[model samples]
Target: MKAAKAPQAPEPTGDPAERLRELKAGLARAAALGGHPPPSLIAVSKTVPAEAIRPLIGAGHRLFGENRVQEAEAKWPPLLAETPGLELHLVGQLQSNKAEAAVRRFDAIHSLDRASLVTALARAIDRTGRHPLLFVQLNLGREPQKGGVAPEGLEDLLKDARNAGLAIFGLMTVPPAAKEPAPYFALLRKLARRHGLAGLSMGMSSDWDIAASLGATHVRIGSALFGPRG
Candidate 1:
C-alpha cells in the first residue's frame, strides 16, 4: 500500500489576481486530500483599498471579508454597485449595537459568540428582512484576548441563538497564534459534529491547507490572497 501524499501549500505571488488563482487551485487540491469538498475562500480584504481589490474582483473572485462594519460601509457600497453578485463577510468582532448595520452590509457574520449578539442579530433580521449566515466562534485556546466563546459556553450560546430565531450555519475559531493549529481545527470539527452543525470556518493564511484537509467549509485568507495589510 502507498502512503498518502500531503496537500501542497498555496504559492501566493505578489500580484493579487495571480495569487487568487494559485490559492484557489491549491485549496482544490488540498480539499481533495481529505476527500472533502472545496471550501469557500473568503479573501480577507480588511484594510485593502478598493483599487487593490478590484483586480481580484475582476479576476472573477466575488467573496470578501472585512474586519469592521464602518470601514466596509465606507468602501463597499460603490464597489458592490459596480459589481453585481459580490458577497461580503464580516470576520471581526461585531458590536451588538452594529447588528443592524452588519446585517445590512454583510452576507455572512463569522463572529457570533454571545447571547447579546444573538438578540441583536435577531432584531436586526426582523427590521432589515435580511438573514445573514452566522457562525459561532470558539476560543479553543481559551485566550482572554480573542473574541470567541469558551468551549464550555458554546452550547448555551447556541441555545440562545436558537431561541432568538438566529440561524447558525457554522462554527469559527482562531487558534492560538504561533501554535500548531491542526489540533484546534480537528477539535472544532468534532464540536461542530457533536452539535449537528455542518459548517466549519477554520484556518487562515498560514494553515489553510491543513484546515481543508480537516474538513473546513470556509477558510479566511488575507495576506495569502491580498498580500500583507498596510
Candidate 2:
C-alpha cells in the first residue's frame, strides 16, 4: 500500500453552525490567553454563498467579508434586507470605478492601500454622501505583489486620504504567511497607537492570538472560521 496516503481532508458540507462553532472556539482560546474578548470576527464569506450565510445569520454572526465589489454588490443587498442589519465589508483590492457601488454596499473597506484609490473613495463618498469605514492597508511583509501602501509610506498616503475627505478608521495587514506573526502584529498595534486610530484589523484564524493580545480591534479569520472556500 502507498503508506495510507496521509488521511484525506474533511469535506465542508456547507454547514454554518460548524463554521460558527469553529470560529467561536478559536476566539475563546484567544480570549483565554488574556482577560478580554477577541476584538471582532469578520467572517470572510468571499466564496461562501448567501444561503450558507443564512445559518451564520441564524447563529448570530452579523458581519461578513467579501472580496470583490461586484460580487458583493450582487450578493449582499438581499442578505442585508433579510438580515435587517447585516454589515458586509469589502476586504479585497477595490478599483476606482467601483468606489461608488462599494461605498453604497459595504459597511467597511479593509484594503485601502493607494492614494489613487483613496481619492476615488472620497470622490465616491461625495457623490453618494455616504462614508464607509476605511482602513489603511500596510504592506507589512512588503510583498512585491501585495496591494497595500508600504509601511514607510502609510502616513503620507493617509494624510492625502484625509485631505481628500476619506474617513480612515484604522489599519489592516497580512504578515508574511507563516513564520511567527507576533512581531508584525505588534508593529501594527504600535502604528495604530502612534496614529490614535481606533481600529487595528490584523490576524486571521492562524495568528489571531498574537493579533488580539497586541490590540487588534478587528480580526478577519477565514479558513479557521469557515473552512476552505473551494
Candidate 3:
C-alpha cells in the first residue's frame, strides 16, 4: 500500500493578510487529505498589538484568540467596535477570580480545565448572561507544569461544568513540546468523540496542518501570522 503523504506547511512569510490566506489554504489542503471540512482559524493575537492585528481584521478575519484577559480587555474592544462580527476567544489559562471579566469580554473560553474554574465560570455566565463556548483543556502528556486537566480528571470536570449548565463545546490540548503532535491530536479527537463533543482546539503555529488533518474544529495560529513578538 502507498504511504499517505503529509500536507506541505505553508510558507511563513508575507504580510498578515497574505500569511492568513496561506495558512487557510494549507489547512484546507490538509482537511481535504483527511476528508474533513476546513477548521476555523483563530489568529492568536496574544502579545500582538492592535495596529499589527488591524490588517488581518481589515482582511476579513474575525476569530481571534488572546492569552491574557487584561491584554485582550485593552486591545480588542475598540477593534471590535470598529469591525462588526468579531469573535474573541480566551485561549490561555484562566483564573477562577477572573471568570466574570473573562465571561464579559470573550466570546469563547478554551481553557476550562478544573472544577473551581467550572463553578466560577458558570456563576459568571448566570450573573452576566453570557455563556461563552467552553472547551476542556486536556493535559494529554500529564505534565505537571502545564495548566490542563489530566485525562483521569476530565470526566469529573466535564460533569461539573455540565451540572453547572455551562455548555461544553469540546476539547483542547498542547502536546508535549518537541514531540510529533499527530498522536496528541488523534488522542484529543478520540476523547472528543467519546464525550460526544465536536470542537477540537488543538494545534498552534507549528503543527496546525497536522491538527486539521485529524479533525480539528479550531486551530490556533500565532507567530506565523503576526511574526515574532517584540
Candidate 4:
C-alpha cells in the first residue's frame, strides 16, 4: 500500500495573515491524517523586523521563535508588553553564559545540548525562578558545525540535566540540508520515547507537514511564513 502523502503548504499569498492561516490549515490536516493533534507552530521570527511580525500577532498567533538572544531582546520585549499571552521561544544555539538571559527572555528554549549548558540553565532557572520549557537538541546528522549533543552522549546529558534539577520537555533537531528528513524525524520520535520525552521539536518551513504527520510536537517555521528575509 502507498504511504499517505504529507500535507503541502498552501500556495503563496501576498497577505501574511492569509499565509499564516493556510500554513496552519495544512498542519492541521497533516495531523488529522496521522490521527494526532497539530503541532505547535513556532513562527521563527529570527532577523525578521517587528513590523513584519506584527501582522501575524495581529492575526492571533502567539507562538514565535528567535535565533539570537540579542535580536529577540531588541524587539520582543516591547511586543510582549503590548500583547498579552505572547510566547517567545529561543530556537538557536545558546551560549552557556547567556542561559540566564535566555531563560529570562524566552518562554521555551529548543537548544539544550551540553553539560555546561545543562548546568547553566539549571542555575539560571534556580536564580530566576523561571522554569522555561527545555528541549535537548541532538546532532542527529553528526555535523561538525551543529550544536546538538551527539546521540551517544544524550543519555548521560539527560541524566546530568535531571540531576541538576532541570526538567527536559522534549528533543529537538535540524536534519541535514538536502537530505530526506523523515528518517531523522522518525528517529527523533523513537529517541523521545526512549528518553520518556513527549515533545519533538523538529521540522521547519520546508518539511513541517511531514514532521507533523510523523508526530512532531513543535515545528520551527521561518521563510515559508515570512517570505525570504531581506
- Answer with 2 or 4, whichever has the higher TM-score: 4
Tens-digit lDDT string for candidate 4 (68-141)? 99999899888999999999999999999999999999999999999999999999999999999999999998
lDDT values, one for every candidate: 0.91, 0.79, 0.90, 0.91
Q: TM per model?
A: 0.95, 0.88, 0.95, 0.95
- Name the 10 consecutive residues with the lowest summed lDDT in model 1: 2-11
Cα RMSD (angstroms) for every candidate in the order listed: 4.4, 5.1, 3.7, 3.4
Reference-based lDDT, residue 13, model 2: 40
- The alpha-carbon deviation from the true structure for residue 217 of candidate 3, after best TM-score superposition, in angstroms, is 0.4
Q: In candidate 4, which residue pairs clash? A: none
TM-score of 3: 0.95
